[model samples]
Target: MAEQGAPQRRPSIHDVASHAGVSAATVSKVMQGVATVKPANVQRVFDAVERLGYRMDPLASELRRSKRRIIGAVVPEFESEFFGTVITELERLAEQRGYALVAASSRESEAREKEILARMHDWRVSGVVLAPVRNERSPAAAFMKASGMTGVMIDRVLADNAFDTISADSAAASAEVARALVGNGHRHVLVIGLGEQAATVHARLEGFRAQALALAPDMRIDVILSESDVAPLRASLRDYFGKGERPTAVYSLFLKGTLVALSEFRRRGWHCPNDISLVGFDDAEWMQVTFPAIAAVVQPVRRIATQAMDLLFRRIGGEEGPSRALLEPCKVLMRESVGSPGGGARAGGGDGQ
Candidate 1:
């Protein structure tokens, strides 16, 4: 032991290698979890690290590796459960790989999304995971390509093919929802979506429409693109009901829309599956606790997070090939919310004021 006033010498990778009877490079590879490293060497390195209390300096390691040990993640909304779960899982995966994450929410603004990308460039992050906004002309792929930055797109995809993307099979899943609704004997239906700004939403609409029309060409499926805010959604719903005949069932493209629809129905004193049927694209905790459990298509958040990180790291690690689009299947849970269509709005129902 050293004197009280003396500084302690921190054990270095060289010391660990010497104790483990391996080269410094081998120790480094083991610490990095390189599959090429021998199993016995990895065990020895860990044992030596434990015995010597050795800790690698992140800054020095980053400099030596010629890349920052930080990843940037940008999403449309951080408040939503889907994106919140994604960021949490990404942070966990990054920590496991000895990297840090810088997360940002664009709040569904194209300008804000662009600004976040620029900041990621300034920070010289090792890579990015972007869930782009609804703009058709987003320059994310071009910017990343120009800056020699690597990334993976998650949730929503752009038209560009420069980056790998991971998302649920929105079209097929939405089509499945349509099949369920049509099979339940609902001919007239309403589809409430945020807008066509997101490729995910667009895909969902196209899939639902295509499948529904294919099944029953005479079916009346009315669609309305509502603003995501509660008041605007309520207004849109009110206007829809006031304009024409009421739908037997409603399919909301997102969670907020689902909640707003439920609230609107409750305000009118309409019973779910009795007066109107409902389905949503996203699964949420509150959806289950309500009077009637909501039917939803559950996106595999963990799988998406894992796949995005895997793809992003692969790009960062110099993997070269065509950019890939990975789509995971969604699980549809048909709960009590979906049922046979009622005739129309009931007599005692509120005026939806």
Candidate 2:
């Protein structure tokens, strides 16, 4: 046959039941360890499952268990400094408040994030803290509609106002960065960004553009947006920078964008702050050690995380009212990499050097 040697797809629960000469419902009961099932039938179900390499999804099993004092947290990823820091603080604070934290990585996949949310629901966690994947109506909304688990959002702001949210004011920070650069004599700027579906990224971009245009009526603020593909990101950056007309400074809206843009600059033998001024929305550890340590508008991760947990606790304690959001202030950490749009740092704006 043309398909010879191709592996057969793994068996499903139905297939396992058919192979064991039992009904799907019976197999499900056996898998759930129902003592009422005949012992022989239980053995047959297990044998069939093992032979077919069939395994139960943890959610299915979790559905049968009693609830726990667990709080679930879902983040896009930790490559960015803010998310990793927020999760660490959330877990630490959760422990102090006598709760357990279960963390999941969405890897920036909306579908995967939804599956994780469903799993959390099935496991009957007392509450959840979410840094939702960006979408018009992300799984966060679906989760709210389909489950009773109380969720408090952090980092990314969801469009829906049906849930409590805690986050540093990303828009304010972006505006501040724009002001700093304009004050340092920069006329034109470029924003390199991804997280196209994310609400927080959108807010930051809006703020930056609004402030840049307002500050200098003649300034040009160029934007480059893409999905989370690294190859396309590199190619796009190369294409933009390869052009004759370049923005005076570059602002990276996402951490991935920041790291990728830095690599591209290095590949082109361009030095930051010397060739182009730079800043990011989030500060990373390596930024502190970079040749011309990069400037960033930094979030207060610990405070945001703690506040999110507080909101979750309030919801869990049956506090009922219209959902609200708490926006904290963010500050620009001016460093060597952000100075004059043309060459070097400002007279006294430099950090360290």
Candidate 3:
């Protein structure tokens, strides 16, 4: 007695059972491929399901099967080679351990990250791995803690101290690089792209300034915050390079700022290490192939990814332990970007002439 042109709702298991002349319980058993259902009835239920377009919910089915098999990975940016490598390694490890990884990018926005976490929660993911934003805490972090969801943090740590963290030794690494530059006879050095209060950046700045000042008491150390943009950095570098009091060497804290500094130098036809020595954090694939390869502090991406997955799995298994803090060393790659005080070869280039 339904209206002829009325829209129809998709069928459910009850509709399948009614059409197949079986109980709802029988339909469910057959749909689940239980051995107790008669072969003929199973076939009939399957036919009814196909006809009605009835589909089983994956999360519900997974729960019924009692499998803790899904984990979520949230990162700030997917376009960066660094995060891409982390995701790739995590996925491979997850698959090896009979688990699946559902990865999402926060795009460096708190609201977007919160929504992604909600979606992952709806999917009944067993655990989560996150690289929180540099300055702000993610809403998802508190939610995950409240919901009893297991999680591990990579790269930046959340301010709440609710989740385990695995990060590179930013402070120590930056200090070593500063020492290297100072050891090479560079007196005045500049560090770029870190905010004054950013934990990672602050640590690096502390180390760099401490070491530079320790080596030469009269050292002039300058720190420039990038404000997350390249134009200001380019302008600053250009102005500094044009000035007669430019730092003997420049150390860029982030990849984007590093690239901007390199491009600005190249555009102005200034040679690296010769005119002004440069060093940057994070190594990229093309770094070694550039005109003059850039020196970098490289973090072990694969190892960090693997350890994060392991911690996430253990937490999902209801293992109770203190929050973990891991610090991996950064390997410094020596290239043509660093040299002595008078420049490696172009010392007498006459101050941006």
Whose TM-score is greatest here? 1
Cα-based lDDT at residue 281, candidate 1 = 90
Q: Sort the predicted structures by TM-score, highest score first.
A: 1, 2, 3
lDDT of 1 by residue, 1-353 (tens): 67998988999889999999999998877666465667688679878887887777888887787667889999989888999999999997776555789999988777788888988998878889988886324676567678878888888773456888889899998999888878778899899889566788899999999999999898899888865455777898988776765898999998888988898888888888889988899899998887678888899999999999877766776678898988898988887787777643223322111
What's the TM-score of every candidate structure? 0.84, 0.78, 0.75
- lDDT values, one for every candidate: 0.81, 0.77, 0.74
The best candidate by lDDT is 1
lDDT of 3 at 234: 80
What residue pairs clash in candidate 3, if any at all? Answer: none
- Point out the worst 10-residue segment of candidate 2 by lDDT: 344-353
lDDT (C-alpha) at residue 268 in model 1:
82
Least well predicted 10-residue stretch by lDDT in candidate 3: 344-353
Root-mean-square deviation per candidate: 6.2, 14.2, 11.7
Global local distance difference test of model 2: 0.77
Roughly what TM-score does model 1 have, to 2 decimal places? 0.84
User: Candidate 3, 170: how far from true, in Å?
Assistant: 0.9
